[model samples]
Target chain A: MPMWEESSLVRVVPSARPRKLAKVPFVELADGRLQGVVSSGSDISRVYVSSVAAGDFAFACRTNNNRPCGGLRGGFCNHVTALVGEAVLQYGGARVARYLQAETAEAADAAGTAAVPTAQQLTAAMSAVRPQQSADGQAVTGQVFSRFLRHLAYLELPATTAPLPEMHWFPTAGAVA
Target chain B: MRADLLAAELPDLDEALAAVDAFDEVLAGGLLRPQPAQAAGLNALADAVAGSPIAALVAEAAEKAAAGVAGEEHLVALAAGRTALFGAVHDAVLARVDEATGRPREAAPPFEPGAPLPVNLLASARAWLCDVARAGWRGMDHELAATAAPVVSALLPSAELRRLAVLLDGFAAELAASCPGRTLEQIPLRRWADLWARGMLLTQPGAIAAAGAAAESAAGAASTALTGRLLPLGVDLHEHATGVQAQVHAVFEPADGGPARLVRASVSAPKPDTVVGAGAWQLLRPHLSLLAAAGEGRAMELTGMPVTDEGDLLWSDDRAHVGESADVFTTARVALPAVRSGATAPLDRHPTRIAEPVLVEGYTVDGSGAEVAFVIGGERLAVDTGRVPAASPLTPQAVAGSRACVGLLRWDAGRFRLQPLAVQSAAKSKAAVAQAGAWAGGTSDKNAAKAEKAATDAVTVLRERAGRLLRS
Candidate 1:
């Protein structure tokens, strides 16, 4: 799967203000993406999606409120992660991988001669970078996957989709076709 | 007697007697007629006298006229002369009384002691003592010693008593010489004591003492009250007054609440600026000393020409500017000379570059009192001191602004900081631009741009000069 397509799901709180709540709807995206809003208080909330199938992803979020509040965690919530993951599984990660690789290559070029690795090459490098464990040791793939997900979140990416733009989702096979 | 001559003389005699009665009435009434009318009346009387028998009887009428008694001219002259003589005596007595005590001499109840000494009197005594001390009168006689002792006792109960007493003794001895062969009743001990006190108050010791006490007490009370309400901020309060172009008293009080015991100060001067009266030095002295002890920096004393009436130039002639209507006064700018004491590292030795004299300007409104303004270079520095009386010592704060330039040049090296002292308008900011321009050798411009340019240039020059001095 493409690194960008490898989505994770995490819970979030929703904001309290009427305008903020209106901006974050409870219904799925117009294109059939799964999404839900969560909040710790009326003033603060996080719109998110969570699923066992998808790994966890979260970002700090902010409102127009002048008071100090949390920011969008990696610009995505669990709901967006779930939506992306579902889309990725149905469509396959090849196109998304290509897109992510192109963006990273462009960034590398801008930074002046850092090696621009392909998506497959980057995945291979990640696998190598993971610490080796004993054969009888506990399965460390979950930890490795979590660390990789965090590193991908940290990576600055060019905006592929405009924020709060209309979203579309398709069934896995149909989308791939 | 010839019948015709006798008849003519009789009528003249009657006229003369009538004139005498009129003169007696005028004198008895004690009415002060206008000068011109009085002169005219005397002239008319004198003309009648010249035509009378008295002139005819006198062989040497010209001689009598010269003596101012025989003819009409003589009578007129005598009247004017007598009037002048009486006026002079009155004026002299009034002036003398004002000098002896701190009140108006002509006012009722002259020399009323036991009442609180006028603030100006205390300030003057303090200034006089300082001058005497500076003059090395430490070993002066009883009169001098007496002059400073009581005044010092009044102000500084704990410190410098012995020195002050010696000065007062010398002053008292001098007084003894003035009252030759007179018994104590003729000039009572109380009167003598008051005179001695007045002298000391005019000097440095008395001013220092009164200012020290007033500043210490007031500052203590204020600090105590303020500390409870606000953050524990240390404040030094000073006060002073002036009269007739002399410093009466100046006082300074340091923070008494903290480990720093309040440093009390006072001083007096004959020609203190209107603000921070002559007595201000007494109030300010202790603070200067305290600041010096704290290793704040060195003080610089800078003398400047007072502003003149025509607004033409600054001159050192003290008499030139008085009574002339002008917006600026020639202020004696005292900048505490730079001292190197409290710095962690050795500073670069800088040549002492004297700063340009600062101009203190302000206007006097009839009911509102004197409002003085001070300008240092181009900027209008805040004047934190009180009103300026004719006679008083300048306060350290009054002098602090000009001293700021000195401070900038001389790094505060734990010695004493030079601060600007001024006798200027209380409205420090508004008229400062004009003052600065005047100081920088430019006529006050009505145009904003020109005035601003002049101010900028003056400031730049001052800063550059200060910096160069510091570097050197």
Candidate 2:
């Protein structure tokens, strides 16, 4: 996704007004996890979220504490929420729906059906289930559904988020270079 | 309006304030005989603890930490007193802010930029000399009396030449009150340097900078004298450059100090390139924290990959938005001989390499693609050791716990380009060990005697083993 759009998600999610910044280059890992480098003052930190493409959706940033967004402590913070939102924007609802489905679609998928609910299908199903339940029950259902969706929201689409095979960058010897 | 602006900066204040304990703990822990290199970071931390007041306590705390207390009770009382003093200052900052905004407190006079400035070199020098003498009189450093004597010399007074000198006899006499040697004249450079440093505490920061520049002018006198590129500092060049291998003995917690309102992320290597990052202190904090945690006191090698200075890459992004400039922190205070030669850790363990490193979480660092940290002195550290010159011996297989001098054009703890130099070889060292083993394989009378001794001691060993077995 374009970096400006991603930044706008920063404002949009716990999200505030968007500020133009250097483009945050987010690459899609082969396993469907979306990864990116966010500027950390002369330094850059690695932020990534797992694809429900396989199973559980996970979110992490090297700069973050055990709690998301540097342990603000209340809940998933603006940074994580924004990154996840950017992933959803980049990968499309359908792709995220696939990863989220991978996490909870054990029984039927194990039976060789392999069909997992797409992001749109899940969103529709989540909305569809609300009317049948009480208000509090719907709130709980919405919270759980939103939590799952948030992780998938940041997953890069398989179409654009290709990451190179495993490799790391290190310094070589000689004079400074 | 000022309070409102300061209110907007509360987060930065919070960080500097919060860092009080972490920074104070490190300083207090090493209160005894703290190295000169430890001073800068501690000063930065102290600023956050209580602004200038905590700073006033630093020299005294350093003295107390150095002077052996009679008991732990005394030490605890000394520390508690310092803590209480710091708390008072912290409270004072908040209290003043509230008071200023709430009542009719007179506004602080604004700084007049174009006013006559203190550029009277002679007056400042005399003032500094008198201060040094007074400090000696107060028993701060009696050796300073020797340094003060030369400034008062007839020839020196007539010539008005500011130069390095050695007044060896006066110092010993001043402290001992009965020494054989009288005050001597100007001697050789090295001896002059040694005695000159002995009286360094007597010299003011402005004088030190002047001396540094003067030393630069006398570069032709000494063969090993710092010149064009050999010195740690760059001449007319922007990016800082050099090769130094030293342990990161301590990483001071990020703190704000000085008139510039800049927070400094200063590191001191054995051959340290302490490029103090100032002005944007608040924005520069998180980066300092990482440098504090990851590279502090750890064997790290960095190269100043200056774009012009035969370096490979720039650690800072050329296209990145400029936040702060190196020029802002330039002052006489920055000219202190930051690291004493004695402060550096022995450097025979690490391999030499340089690069503009970022320390990404999952990139392969070593040749073996091992995710393991570089373990040394029982601390696990992650340093980028991946790519190198074909002739370089800094591969992961080669780099271990060796001390590395880091060369850099600049350092803010946020972004710095460092190259490791003077690396001690792991392969050659292991090969030497293997060679020793091979020599052991040869028949030597000492080895034979040792074997015989082992055999003779087998009975005692057996009894100990049997007893252990019985207990089990």
The i-RMS of candidate 2 is 30.4
Q: Candidate 2 lDDT, tens digit per residue, A46-164? A: 22221211223343343321112353232333443444454445444434444433332333455666554443444344333322212132232233222222222211111100010
Model 1: how large is the Cα RMSD against the reference?
41.5
lDDT of 1 by residue, B132-236 (tens): 322222123323433543353343222323223223433333332222212212222112222222233323222222222322344445422211000000112
How high is each candidate's TM-score?
A: 0.16, 0.19
Of the candidates shown, which would achieve the greatest lDDT relative to the real structure?
A: 2
Quote model 1's iRMS.
43.8
DockQ for all models, in order? Answer: 0.00, 0.02
Candidate 2: residue B52 lDDT (0-100): 48
User: Model 1, residue B161: what's the lDDT?
Assistant: 33
- Candidate 2, residues B9-120: lDDT per residue as tens digits? 3234345433433333333223334445445434444444444443545544434434522123222333333343334433334333333223222222232222221334
lDDT score for candidate 2 against the true structure = 0.26
